[model samples]
Target chain A: MYVESTGIQVIETIEELQKTLNRNERKDTTVGFVPTMGFLHEGHLSLVSHAKEQNDIVVMSIFVNPAQFGPGEDFESYPRDREKDLRLASEAGVDIVFIPSVEEMYPADGGIRILPGRQADELCGASRPGHFDGVLKVVLKLFNIVDPDRSYFGMKDAQQLAIIETFVRDFNLRTAIVRVPIVREEDGLAKSSRNVNLTAIERSEAPAIYQALQSGVEMFADGANPEAVERQVAEGIIANSSGKIDYVKILAYPELGPVTDDTEEIILACAVKFSSTRLIDNIIMSTKDGTPCSE
Target chain B: MYVESTGIQVIETIEELQKTLNRNERKDTTVGFVPTMGFLHEGHLSLVSHAKEQNDIVVMSIFVNPAQFGPGEDFESYPRDREKDLRLASEAGVDIVFIPSVEEMYPADGGIRILPGRQADELCGASRPGHFDGVLKVVLKLFNIVDPDRSYFGMKDAQQLAIIETFVRDFNLRTAIVRVPIVREEDGLAKSSRNVNLTAIERSEAPAIYQALQSGVEMFADGANPEAVERQVAEGIIANSSGKIDYVKILAYPELGPVTDDTEEIILACAVKFSSTRLIDNIIMSTKDGTPCSE
Candidate 1:
């Protein structure tokens, strides 16, 4: 595979990206964007793979995005391997790699900031204060800079993808947002760079996350109540030798709604802290009454 | 001037706009939008005029945007003149007039919405709860429907304009927002559809709104302190035979900040209650210290 390290040519600043995209816009070229936080995991590659298939030119952005991380969070220690990531991205058939510095993304005295509202008050936003606002702010900045025809996002960050979909719908974003299914490891551990932080033993037990979620789905499939399905999933996770349940509540996907008997989608979402590494996993399954059962 | 007496195509459904925009997207034509609450005054015409100058196609939407109005406020009695607005917009060169019903915009379920953050919380937002949110929600809907290359807004709604600018910048909206200067009556009353409600006496007093604002600007030119300038403007408005000062203050133009000695590009904004009619006016002025001054 020919690996091209775009040392200043591909995209360095917002101006450079805008120039490239604007030129394409005039010529009517279809541009696609895949935004990634950089560690080159299979999950991110899946999104890139989808973007490459859909558009004439694919632009992949690899930035850690500090704003998305909260106080005492793992922003500084977030996994990054530029040389390896570039090699993987280049191999994945990405047309351009947009590597922008923090300074480039956020200028000094930048007054512009995006604050997500009520919907932002739920899901991951509830735990990580200012997380979605940061996500939205940067995503918007990237979208404006890239001005792509279609943007690709992986379902691994399910809530993030949902929020972006809302952003696209609510704000009338011009770019079409294409969502790809979450890519997982052979054992069903959702592919994540955070998987790197797991110990060998912890990694073996990690598939239990998916297993618990599946159990909840199976219960819902077998005609159990949504609450019963949620309870079962929580039980399964807590029963795991290495898993400590953080939260395994059933909610409406994206909206983070409470379980309602009348409605059909109750997302079975779970967060578990394992070996000082926190992992979140969820499943959206239709229940007997038509609610989502996320085990 | 060509006049199209197009009947109000008042459809509140977002799905329809989405479908229309998607269809338009296939043709790849430049689209421009002017979002307005139904009462089309000269202020709105300036925006439509600017939009006409910039884009291949123009869309002017008329909705009273209830979110921008506070409870017990003018939501019920706010100006609604579809027939007149249509004639005015057509004369100003609007290509499409989107008149969505409230049920269409807010759906029966009223699920999904937009959030206009901190900047929106200040200024008019302080008096009007959820005003910017409503503005954002509708603007996003219109943007999606029109998929405009450029959109126009009048600066007479200064706070609204700033909030929209902040929203676009923070959200990474693809469309370029063009702000048109405020249009005024010969007597200097800021052109508003609401002006139609003024009685003969109220109409006569309306001009005082502008005169008071002008006095504030003149005071700044005379080396008056920011506090003294504000006092002069307040005194002028109250002293008017038919004017009742609602608010007379000096502040930074874009940020709506408190006036300091170093403020530049300041605004002297005033609102006066003339019997039952409320009139607002402002004058832009520069400070000696190169910072915005507020009156």
Candidate 2:
């Protein structure tokens, strides 16, 4: 299914990426970028597919950033299979595979944080600590290196997506930050490269996360109070088939702030554990005032 | 003289700036950006002059970022004369003048600090509190808007320059951040728009700021102990200056970290008060064995 070599290119250095992009930068051809830490999945593909449809060129970056991972968080154990990822990206019609090494991304004495303000401090800020900082830092670096006209991201990482949105605005970034819907497994687990690490039993129980989020969505859809919606989502997760509940929150979508009263848009989101693996999922719902399902 | 029209391209929306820049984004043209508050000064002019030399187009952004200003500090009272700044920038051969209103830079709701972590949490971090957060937030927005080939900053704002340097590296930003040498008054007072607000007595005492920094540089050059050099510099300012000493530090040059005896490439920097105004400056120095003055 691969077209002749003109369709896709691979870049590992800032200079090469810039040289390639420099040619198209002057033209009206829209370039869309999808940045990933490799180990590609349908979720990333969903972004790629959307990017392919929107722009004339699609640039996918596969650099597993170490800065985003905490002290003991999955920096080493983070699943990676570049061969598989490369094939999947090629199949998805990606125009370029910008796979930079750790040294390429961060030279000795490299320092920068692409994190956004208030948005990062909330939600995942507490859990991952420097997670959003790392995400924004890398995304920004990618944006500069790729110089894309538009960049696509999966909404599964709603907080990360929100922070990027803020970063683009705050930094006056040149690229458009486009967000695609969260692609999920048939059973409702939000698709992630990390999903590959889940044990068979953990994978089976993964759908409970979607179920809990769906229950919250349903509650909000049925005119439940925002507080009550949060409670119901937590209760639903606690009653799940397997795993410990890390957090069950019904927040304002997009902003990731606490949901107050019966907001027009509420996001039913959660993080849960099946043994050592952690999974997160969410659903956006709206109210009668025509507020968005995902705020 | 007056070449291009200057209306303070008041972009209240990030989307608007994106739309405008997208239409104008070009390759091969070096875009030089100089970010500042509205008040114009020779110090800022010096930066613009440097930008004009290397760039085909120069974009000067006048934004008094509220985030950088401390509470009970003069965020509201910060000097702003758009007409004056436009005239000065236009006279200095600027191509574009970007003067975004507060709402243009920040969303009504988002409050996240753009650059966070240990780098941000040091130096001015402990003193101004959220000051660096504000500086970074605004600077990121400015960079995004300008998307310059090389951005120019004055060495007068050494820590700010350091943070921006770190920001570019961490995010993998392609924009080259260039620091211009510090411009000083003939009297040795560091050129700052804030210098205008100083009382006559404070103005007379301002030269001591530079003098003390020079002494620190001389001491370090003469192979004096770094700590002793820093102490002498601080003591000199406190003894002769009208302003209270905020911080008199000899930091490792470029890194903006603390200096030890073995530190090389050091910067003797300080901020002191004169009545209601605060003035800051630094002199770059190197220790033996090539370590920054601060280690």
Candidate 3:
């Protein structure tokens, strides 16, 4: 199913993707999937690389899902580089690169939707209503289409990763969710597709988001309570970044519940808005062992 | 994966069911699934028989989905005869019978749900709000668990069939939806588990619901408009039974839209409540050629 020129299969239709995957599945080939919005960065390629190592075949889907974007969001202006993305995907060892059009993905009105529960109420979902619902919708569709053995998601979008994990577990889906470490730049800013939208000044200030999360992680390690850790993180972002703080808090890891004495894992997370760009970063830490669990 | 005595494998947990199916699936065995609430009547057995005919292995699931039942909607008093259901399933050629406990299916607060669209609004959904949402939720979970090549659904619950079809199509699910025609009693009453709940007099009168749908089919065959067909069906139900009419509708099939000159297929459907028992029956018809497409 490879394109002769690139040696990477580029599938544009669901029928063809299903046909190719069906043939591979019959041969007991395990598929690892990485879903993205078509702007391949180091973060996305890291997921692809992780996928390639774990399974016989790697499938990367590049769909700029409109459902996840709210009004006034950057859906229309969202960056896309198909040519560069394919080259990066091929280099990353993707066996199949699924590039479905909006029409190809959603040929009809999607009467059926996956609604998130309390897990979607805070963080990014707080600012953007119905955002997690849209994410779950597209992910479920792609899961059904690809039928991958394992699906890879980066922890950079920690909340999105958490919500997706909850969905797969609750739905009893066969695909195992694999969490990859977030890819970051040398200056310690998390790699993101939206980073291109940042102005030079905003770009310089953006690293503060991760720095604040690290500060929160240190406070938690020093036996700070959840409230203290939250306040320190918020103050750090205010002190260094031109971006307005959207939210800064520490909560139980995947559950996103209130941190209590029994809670072992916690997430130090924050979102900051710089002019027209919004940036989010988080550090998952083990509260009991005093160690950072994820970047 | 068979229970030696009965020659039918009965799986109680998701893990065991997945193990059995995975083994079979690796051998390229096609699975045909029939999902039921477990008080098996002729209609349900018919679905099992259809599944048996279509695939190398037939899997039947029997669990009364609590999500689909509303408050005060007979969830507690729902009929169950597991021994009899097992026997019927075995006799009907079911290879694997999955009977998961409520706790197994819903171990935690299901923070995710499948919300259905407008196709749910007019029929049973109008009376039972959020009913189709519950239906879609359970159906999607079952589909994920089974991963069948084809799933059999009886057309007796016409709207349920339509909504399931829409969910599969919109979600781009791999399971092919196989529509089995309605199974009826000698008296032409549609066979249902709930029929046993009806009083003797009510049971005698219940056949009128199907008869009314037949009358509506004749009207449509005589070139009756949608409104006229709806009226005739309602009048026939009122004239023949001591029951209250819930709704009688003639809508474009599958889409459940308004029937116009451009419309080719339509559903003539009705619901009648006889004291404690409520019954629904429908006839899918082709308006363009003037014929009943389904019982």
Candidate 4:
């Protein structure tokens, strides 16, 4: 899969990636990074676009990290297609695509992992124990290796983006984190690689996850209490969709803490399992002052 | 007592230090870092000299990290003399000295920490649980903020140095770890800030700790059984000193694992309690192949 003239360098080893990044670093070129667990979708491509526009060189890493996956969590069957990813990433203006095998990222024994503090105890963390901490460890590793001036993450995974942002602040890492808005299908379904696993009918029902989030966002914007917003979303997903509801939560934006009188910019989010495919979506709305309104 | 005209920059925050470093980084200057707990002594000064010799710029941080201290350990009473440290650091050719408050290094609530792998289970770890992991967390934080080309650590804490080197390799940090030889007092006691806390009798008896280490090194050089070597060192320290011995371990150099027939270099390490103060020291001697003889 040769890209005509994109100059996309697809390297598979950490040493080669460091050499590539170092060369750009020596020339005083600012590098931007987009990290992904592959199977390219529009959501990831949007982050790639943001990265390319922000820096002189853009690097995208495609590794289905094993640490983030639990024992029964589809690690063995996670979808991977390097040929398609290569062509799409090249066309998306990624200067370097780092595709490392899991063995390269983690040794036979799992290396050291992060014990994420209080922030990881709520919402999604309850359902998937050690998930976000696993994510933080790998992202921290990538940030150290890539040494990017800026790194992009799609807000499609609001919890993930929030946790990683906290990790950066807590560690005082040099890279700047840029949060991009989620990209959705015309039917309002958020783009996800897991969507491919859904049956046609289940896929049709997946839009309800976003619809529930949208409903909660509207209710919150109308000055409804957080409890009411959460109830409305939860009931809406369970009642209107054929998919099994996982969770519908309403909370403070990046902090993911409880919403109170002091809270501003609430995030209403939900997840649904449609024919064994679990998907999540969220919407952020202002409550009072927009402290971080850059997005 | 300031140096006549040495341009030593003492930064108190991560932001200011980063800004200072970025300017030098842009000029392609190689940065060497030495991280220390305050009350600068010959041991820490040795690390700083090695750092200065290896790079265009030398950065030393004097942070009496509270995390590395377990409850009942010396976090509150850790000796600190900033004025003396400043003069000594400036004399050592340090370009920058970063002294961050615990609040600045660790946010209001101490944030994410690393869960160190197997190597953290033995040695000092058995005496002070979660000690090396705490050291790892702070060092990882320092490496991120410093962004140095090479970092220096004294071999006095052989276990700590080994674990940090493993961390650098495991996480693929850009900084190269350079181990400096342990600096000893004229009486042959390993120099440590904790030495100041000892009573006159304890101070006088401290030389026996190093004497035991030297004895162990001599035994290993003669290819003595590692178990017999450990016994000799423990009994020597106990019989020769008024201090209560904590541990005497002769293990594979950097791995800190059990010694085997193929072991290349051996670390003869000990920790002893002199009244209320704890002192640690070690010596590395070449084995069959001498993998750790780089120093």
How far off is residue B10 in model 4, in Å?
Answer: 1.8
Model 4 lDDT per residue over A200-288, tens place: 88877777777877777777777788788888888888887787767778778777888888877777777776666678887877787
User: Residue by residue across A1-295, what tens digits does model 3's lDDT show?
Assistant: 3493669999999998998888424477788999999899999999998998999999999999999999999999899898999999998888899999999998998477788887777788898998998999899899999998999999988889989898888888879999999899998999999899999988988888888888788878987788888888889888998888889878887888798888888888888888878888889988778788776
Can you write out model 4's per-residue Cα lDDT over B118-233, one digit (the tens) per residue? 77777898899989878987898899898889999888888888888877887788899998888889988988999999999889889998888787877778778888988999
- Report the number of the highest-DockQ candidate: 3
Clashing pairs in 3: none
What lDDT does candidate 3 reach at residue B17? 88
Chain A TM-score vs. truth, each candidate: 0.90, 0.91, 0.97, 0.93
Most accurate candidate by lDDT: 3
lDDT of 1 by residue, B147-235 (tens): 67788887777777777776666555667888787788898778987887788877876776778677667777777777787788778
- After superposing all C-alphas onto the true structure, candidate 4 shows an RMSD in angstroms of 2.7
For B174-277, candidate 3 gives per-residue lDDT tens digits of 79999999999999999989888899988888888888888788888887777888888888888988889999998988888788778888898888888887
What's each prediction's TM-score? 0.87, 0.87, 0.97, 0.93
Better of 2 and 4 by TM-score: 4
DockQ of each: 0.28, 0.44, 0.65, 0.55
**Maximum-TM-score candidate:** 3
User: lDDT for model 3, on a 0 to 1 scale?
Assistant: 0.87
- Interface RMSD of the candidates, in order: 5.1, 3.5, 2.1, 2.8
lDDT of 2 at B32: 85
Question: Higher-DockQ candidate among 3 and 4?
Answer: 3
